[model samples]
Target: MKKRIIAVLMSFVAVLTLSACTETVVELNTVSMFGGTDANRVVYESTIYAFENEHNIRVKDKSQSSDEEWKSTVISNFNTGNEPDVLQFFTGETAKPFVDAGLVMSIEDIRKEYPDYAKNIDDSVLGTHSVPTTGFVEGIFVNLDHFKSNEAKAYLDKDVWTWDEFKALCAKLVEDNADVEGYKPIAYGQNIPHYWIDHLVAAQLGPDYYNVIKGAEGEDKLTNALLKLSEIKDYLSYDETEEFSSQAFLDGKYTFQLDGSWFGGRIELENITVYPFPVVNEEYGSPLLSGFTSGFYITKKAWDNPKKRDLAVKFVEAMTSRETLTKFVTYGGGFAADSEAKPQNETKVQEALRLVSPRADFVVLPLGDASVAGTYAGLVEVQASFVNNQADTAKAAVKTYIEGQTD
Candidate 1:
């Protein structure tokens, strides 16, 4: 009888142990575009660690380093019905196919269910990711030390300036800093000159010109914009490669850099500033190039799993929380979708947030992506030739490029 009692007790203990093991086996799979850089990776890993600690759940992180690779991986996974529980992807038109296929959960419904999670996040930003074709802003990064050293602080200090005044200031900076070896008024990548010229054309003309630029009458406008940008080619620090230009900007060799907000954390500059491309038309405010929205999306697989759904939501909440988003902004130097998350220790990002107007005319740059108006390979090539002192061929090149696009 004593031996029977001992066996029964041992069986009971074994059953309890099996139940505990089953309870602790909950797992959440995740993938993101944040694995490319050290700063981004550190922040992402810390967030994951905190979430895992708090929830006592296993997080299977499958993040990819390359943006192109990440996109391909996610798309393939989604199509194969093997996508992770949570995904970080380009929001806007890029996400539409996934949404249409019912792969993404309704974040709106999630917000309704978890009001605490949605609190303080900007409605516009949330909407941008939730809806189709909604976008975000792009602007320039300035080296504050270079600006102050060249006595061109007034251009940024003042609220507004005309096209001519902006040009004169750039010219003056080049002339004033001519004695400084390797110094240039502007630093920009050869591969992305079209990105800079797009902003210039939008500022000089208006956002409407983007739609009109492919027409026959738009040839003159395109030529004029090209000529205006070409005027500063002599004042620009020309590098054989894009990476060199970015390095030159960080080394204080250039006063102005036309790049998106991501540039803030990429460089180690102590004093940097950010501004919208200055306005040329007084009737319109600064022309902002609206880029694709990028954010997290909950996969249908995660949402359908009753056991893991709430845990996934909690992870999203932790990732998008003001504290986490603030860390991203402070370290990565990009605007956060969380409205209440203020940037700390990043002056350039702070100034950019302050300067960018909600009321500004937001236009999409014609990057070859699906979100923008359309892509013209010839447009980029012609701009390059114009900047390289082949100005005489630029107008004809521009015409040919537009014609090809129209055809």
Candidate 2:
């Protein structure tokens, strides 16, 4: 009888152990995602927190110092087969290499599962960034309150203006507002190349940059664009002599500066407003525009790990969701790539959208070629040369730079 009791007690203990094992919480898988930028950090943090609360999973988010650092780290991890489950990568030829390298997994299946993809993201944006994969939208940020209707009408109405017209407008603003302390017409610093690569290229080329660069014999057109850009060298901003564009905008100095929409709220002053880039050559013909969009890519290894893959997709969906996207734009300031993510306050968001909206005659493409940084650097060189009356060498300096970029 005592032996029977002992056996029964042992069985009871085994049952309790099994029951405890069954109830043990299997932690939902954790995923590491890549993000960069202050605005991105804020939006991503909120999104991740929301996702974690909803799904009982922890996210390891790593924000890089810069876009380049993010790319390098992601690419290195991918090569080592230890890439983050999700990566925030820029769209275009820049991303093409990774996709071609078999590093990025195709999201064709994911897109199909989410039918709202097309409805939310515009077709043009899809063509540029995603159709083959996922696409992105590049948003140009403009300051509205600084220019106001009196000064902005000319640029916005025509949508596109010649290089001469652009310079004339800047000069006119400076001339009109000379009494205002440190009131420069516009500002961009030596740090970025867009003043030349994106904005000035369209005005300088007097045609679509894509048409020229993708042409069979595109050198002449490229050279022409280079020359035309050189012509308007004076109009470009000088951060040192003038106020930094962001500082100037904050100080109510310049009418405008070209930047990504993501920078809208942080850099925007209470009195200042935002808009898109204007048409480059409205009178003659619209010039091509350029933009850069940012998004996430998943790795094949991530796919193999079902939990990791699911987590990654969930993160992407969460981050790019209508709700999250709206919040992102509200704080971040770029055009909502998602259909459901339209601006909450039209007055604030719409103004920036209108500036970058597609026009019939105008075109938009990516900036940066082999000599990508040359245009801006060259512009500064020529501007200094001109200001100092070093005319003899300015033309030669410009020629050397334009030619140097191709080789």
Candidate 3:
């Protein structure tokens, strides 16, 4: 009777062990900007799958297509105390609100724990994500094949071109391509006037000009930059829509278009080269308007739970690893935050890096973050008015807008 009782107890223990070994899956919630294009979707899904397989954690990805929409969703989720365990959001001013609200978890502990992983990422790039003041880099995409085929090649032979030379090249393209049905010298959209104004100002005034903007000299510089940008309106197509401008540039109807490196992934074209915006002042070299870091953050909710926190940190590390960042650059066409993962040669990203490397000091934070709050929006409005020829008194109109900012 004793032997039989012992045997029954052993059998029960074996069954319990088996049940524990085969327990249900652990699920983690994550949100990111990964659903926009097919390529981006593939890269993100594959990376997530790898993480899940390695970590034994299932991720419930709730990624959004549009950046604006993703930002709104994250803010709403945070307001309702439903923030995801891991969030992929923009860094800097865009992220300040969340950080101030105590929703974001500082990954300093995680970095200390995984020194090897942290070592690979550029401190400057990571600072942009963490410190809120260190800016991010943005590159311009150019259709190199179009330029090589056109007379504009001579002016673009060097990596850096003077503002006058760039304008002359545009004029030449417009004059030479006059008979080419839909050809335009350059791509322009009234919708993103802020981009035009920002690049022009950065090129003219250097990165530290934001401090100058608080006084008289900065105001003069801003006016000069705006006036320079206004001159390019003559070379742009009369169409006011971004869709029309982007399609025209992609279709090879325009010789040049100023945009972020992500533009490379969205368009299907070959021989597209990336370059810095032409500098108005040669002394400033070529300033790349970069000042927005978009990265992943772990939520406070996730950090409070040990199990969830481990998984979330692991996922963030994996997603930002050199291999994964390379994949991001491959599919997304932006500079990888991981400095060690060098971009492939003869690629658009490589060309951009080479062009911008000489004038690294010129990299500046976004106008909104560096200058007054809500300045970018107001500048955008001013740019549109100037481009539309509505600003009969350009300097006065811009000055009025600048003075109106409460910051």
Candidate 4:
């Protein structure tokens, strides 16, 4: 009986030791475009750090800039069987390659195992991607301080702000700041002119940015839109050195800066306000660029692995949580993916939402985002034509966009 008792105690102790020693530690491989020079880098790192502290998962992040070359490399990794366990990438037509290949997992299939995953973000927001919005909108970021005077303030108060009204306001601003040498009413970088291009195209067509109804080379509407944009070039700064430099705008050199919602996060400017671009076309209301065009994706490789599957899902869930999404809005100036997520009070984030949140009924995205993959890069060429006073060659830039698929 004593020997039997000793054996039982030893077995119980062994079981206890085993239970205490056993733990799940997953090394999740992840990739994102939020690495270098990303506005949300600080918040993104903090979220990942917090997730690590709470879970037994250690992230092996391999993030890079989402440039064309990097995008090509992402597809290369998938082809070479080196895709990350979790990825943040563009959805829709951009991701159609990998998605069609059945390499990325879907929310519908994931629901079979984890029924309650990603239920926080609304269905309309989720659409077919089943991921929270991690995208931004483009708009006019104006220094309200520049407009505190009666002359500019009246423009804002006007019930109908048309292209004519906009031109007059620009002329007035130039006259007021006559002492400021070479002062431009609109600030933008010659290198990055896509923001204005998107709105110009949208004003030509409609606000349905998700599907650019019918835009192609030699289209008269597109030509007219580009022509209009160039017509107002006298008010636009053609600075190659400063790409919407916040410092330049803050210095009161430029009254209006064209930028994305992401540009205004945690900015210290006191009298900054965001307003919709003028309805230049009159036929179509000004198209405001905003909302999610991309999302966190889980690879089939991660889902197939018994160890990485749950950890991957948990990581995505944490990344897209209300708290994290609030950071995305408050710090990153992105649209809040979670309904509970709210921006910091009195921030431009709130101002941006005030400008576009009314259109929450639709899943609107940037006008350029709907273009075929690899075609957007060609826009840089298109911009050069107008910026250099060569409006006649703008159509040639559009022709550069080969009507072919690129992963």
Candidate 5:
């Protein structure tokens, strides 16, 4: 009888242990970072910390990977059901595949609960990516000290310049400083053509290029935009053998370069000024807005935990508030989502606002056909060939490459 009692007690203990194991709290993890490390990640951290404390939730913040590395890791974890609750992703057609595959969770419903999340944010800013995403603008950064007098302010103050006016100013600046020893006419990176393409498209076709083109040949505007891009080849630095455009610009080797506004903070330039990419078509009279999203995405692997998913939505909503969005964008060196928030860094912030505010019809969109992963890769290769005097096949090669990609 004692032995039977002992066995029964042991079985009861085993059952309790199993129940406890099943009930153990699972800590949810979220990874936040851009494709590369920078101030953006810092802002994300601050925002996440505040959110975690408020919600009594835990988030595992992981960041700092090359674009390729991030892509590979995100893809690997997703295929194996090991993805973090939230992962940083680029906004555009590129985000569609994962979203379509059911790898990303839609936060539209979440956005509704927190109206402030969507209120301050320009609905158009979300673009064609996910139903809800974050985006930053792309434009020229000016080193204000580079200019000697108020005359220098004229070009910057024009608010908007047609392509001709902008090119002429760039040429004038280069020509005026030509006699200065050790001056680079323009600091540019050849590894990517989207900056140049964005400028040209904005100039030639306005900002709608990102949303208008379903494919390469759907519209004649693609060809027209390509022609304008071909023209800018003369202005860009052929010697971008260096990987970083901001570094080259900071070193004072080049007068101007095309980069995201975040590059403004990468270096301390008290003399810096930011401007919109020049408008190419005077008739169209529209601002070409280069925008990118900085929103969080939920991977399918995290869907198993509905609580974690809800927490993720809450965190995103918290980060996107008008006050927080403005703070992040201001600190991160870009235009604020809320116009009234007023950036403390007035000069650069004002430049950004002026670039986007007027011309209500001005277009804002991402650079590539979101569906095509490597459309700009060929553009970069072609640019390199042009600089290498391998011009004979560069244009044809790019044209052929893009042509072949379509079918």
Candidate 6:
């Protein structure tokens, strides 16, 4: 009778062990700029699937297109202590608040525990600023089909466009497409004018554009760039909220759009291609707006959770691995943060690299990312006294904003 009792107790213990093993799925929450129709999102999801299969962790992805509204929500979440476990955010002023609040984990801090935390990311590219950086580039996305239909096909044959040539093309596009229903020459809007500002300063300053953030000797160059914004005002369109809509471009109503390399993933059509924004400083040989600017950041919330801490680290490790960053570059996320990844096919991002690399005498980061907060604000503040007002007012407004910047 005692032997039978012992056997029954052993069986009960075995059942309890089985139930515990079955209940070991950890749900990790993450956020990023990978939602919408971005092709990179496919890779991101696939990685998450592989991670779940290899480990007992399930990722709760809450990603969306990164815009002003999305950024506001992220900041609000962190402020209220409802932030995600892992976050993919940018560097510069965008990251300053989070870093200052001690809400995110640094690669340095993580490495003390796991030496190879971000081994895939190089020391040179991991921005020592408040947050680390991956990389991104801005350029012009051209609808080749639209160009062909409008008889502007010949305009794209050149290696690099002179300022005169580029301006002429813009004028021609407006004239030819004015009567076409639902058609527009360019997809620029004052609501989002930084790319225009960025390329113009790059063209005006040549190699000196990078110093604008430092309050360097380029006030005249900046003024000239802002004046060009005035010159091109006729080509811009705004929605009800004075915001730029890339939807027009997506709807195939606009011929050209000044956008970033990351935007390439949104194109599913084969007729699209990319080029450097036109150059005014011919002596500078066509400057291209391209570089590393943002990256993945691990938050402190996950670090404090005993069960979530290691899982979050592993998730981040998989996300920032060399394999993933390479996929990011090849799939049109931007320039490779750690490797020279070329797409297997001729993606628009890869084509932009081919055309821009040899032709561009200089590569520059956007003023928003390159400059201090106040300087970038001065350059990009659309509500300021100068924007969309007049050529003289625009120039004066930008000059005041940039020149008046404090440390």
By lDDT, the best candidate is 4
* Model 3 lDDT at residue 320: 78
Residue 298: error of model 5 in Å? 14
- Model 3 misplaced regions, further than 4 Å: 15-29, 33-42, 58-73, 76-82, 92-94, 105-127, 130-195, 204-218, 227-272, 279-286, 290-293, 300-311, 325-392, 403-407
Count of steric clashes across candidates, in order: 0, 18, 0, 2, 14, 2
Task: Report the poorest 10 consecutive residues by lDDT, candidate 5.
Answer: 126-135
**Candidate 5 whole-model C-alpha lDDT, 0 to 1:** 0.58
C-alpha displacement of 221 in model 6, angstroms? 3.1
| Alpha carbon lDDT at 209, candidate 3 | 69
Global CA lDDT computed for model 6: 0.69
Per-residue lDDT of model 4, residues 235-261, tens digit only: 888777454455688676788877766
Query: Which residue pairs in model 3 clash with each other?
Result: none
lDDT for each candidate structure: 0.68, 0.54, 0.68, 0.71, 0.58, 0.69
Tens-place lDDT per residue, model 3, 225-277, is 67776677788775688788888888877777777655665666766666667
Residue lDDT tens for model 5, 1-407: 99999999999999999898756544567665542646566667787778767766666776765477776776676678777776666665456557767777565644555444445555435433232333456666666545544555577667666677766676666666666665554566666666665556556655555444445453455445655544555656655554665576787656676666556556555565566666666665645354545566655556556667666656656666666766665666556544455556566535554345333345456445432566666655665554444544555655554554453
Off by over 4 Å in 1: 6-10, 13-25, 34-39, 67-70, 91-96, 106-127, 130-195, 201-272, 279-294, 304-306, 326-377, 380-399, 403-407
TM-score per prediction, in order, is 0.61, 0.56, 0.60, 0.58, 0.56, 0.54
Off by over 4 Å in 6: 1-134, 149-151, 210-218, 240-244, 293-333, 337-340, 344-355, 383-392
Query: Over the full model, what C-alpha lDDT does candidate 4 score relative to the true structure?
Result: 0.71
The number of residue pairs in model 4 that clash at the backbone is 2
Model 6 over residues 183-266: C-alpha lDDT tens digits? 666776656767877777778776656565345545655675667665555666544322345877776777778887667767
- In Å, residue 224's CA in model 2 sits off its true spot by 2.5
In angstroms, the error of model 6 at 169 is 0.8
- Between prediction 2 and prediction 5, the one with superior lDDT is 5
lDDT of 2 by residue, 97-187 (tens): 6677877666565565554543444333443323211222334344455453466446656654554566777676666666777565666
